[model samples]
Target: MGAPGTARRGPVGEAEYPPLSRRSGWSEGSFSEMKYYEQGTSAERWERARTFFDAKRYSMAADILGGLVEEVPDQVGPRLLLARAYYHSAQLKRAEDQLRVLVERDPAEHYARLMLGRTLQRQGRDAEAEPHLRLASALAGDFAAL
Candidate 1:
């Protein structure tokens, strides 16, 4: 017979079998707790940041957006808006860096690719700009004609 409370293993080792419910730390209440935790705080931060950006206070906007990005680094909207603020403030190199990260994270974002290409063109780096423009054109398809 096997050891106490131990079941015989199949093709795999004993550890390979699914654990009993008590063995896992999770309980049914964990999801509910997470949902409740995220209810209103994030929305409030986003609204405040958007208002700052709309006021044309680019430095303040950058600060707020930078904090937001740090809190939620994977959020595309904050990154895009931060890049826009940098561009409007004549921080072309910072804008380019932000858009480069965005494009690398999401290659399918044609708008980001196009904007990056245009920024590079403005910086007089046509060689570096060409590939992004081409990618954007391909993604935009026939609509690129407009």
Candidate 2:
């Protein structure tokens, strides 16, 4: 077998949902074909995205979750999962964008603030990360006192 994340479309995923073959007539090229995620009902897609995320297929999860987040902008759960998937996939900018939007929508969301701070830090923007990190810590402390 290959490395941990390399065997992404291996037994579990491949066996369950075989990759769309060229004969099926998708106009997408090879690169897009490889990136194509399985389509299903909303709940099924959510479960698939979660399963992919759990399996460490970060890019696959992110791809699915990104669309889900767009579909349900008011819902924080899918967005958070998308951010996490982006983060793990080394898509720091996208993760930061998602976290920033979450923090803006709900400034009291400590985890989002923390993640925003961390994402910024990961991108080497330490100066910007400081305030968010401090705010996150203060928020945690306040919650602890309650």
Specify the highest-lDDT model's number.
2
Lowest lDDT sum, 10 consecutive residues, model 1, at 31-40
The digit string of per-residue lDDT tens for model 1 on 19-136 reads 2243553334444553322224566757776777798877667766776777888989999988888877778898999999999999989988988998899889999998899889
> How many pairs of residues in model 1 come into backbone collision?
0
In candidate 1, how many Å is residue 115 off? 1.6
Q: Candidate 1's error at 64, in angstroms? A: 0.6
Runs with alpha carbons beyond 4 Å of true place in candidate 1 = 1-41, 142-146
Model 2 over residues 1-146: C-alpha lDDT tens digits? 33322223656655433344456543335445644464665677789899999999999998898878877889998899999999999999999999988999999999999899889999999999989988998998954523
Backbone clash count for every predicted candidate, in the order shown = 0, 0
What local lDDT does model 2 show for residue 53?
A: 96
**Candidate 1 residue pairs that clash:** none
- Scored by TM-score, the top model is 2
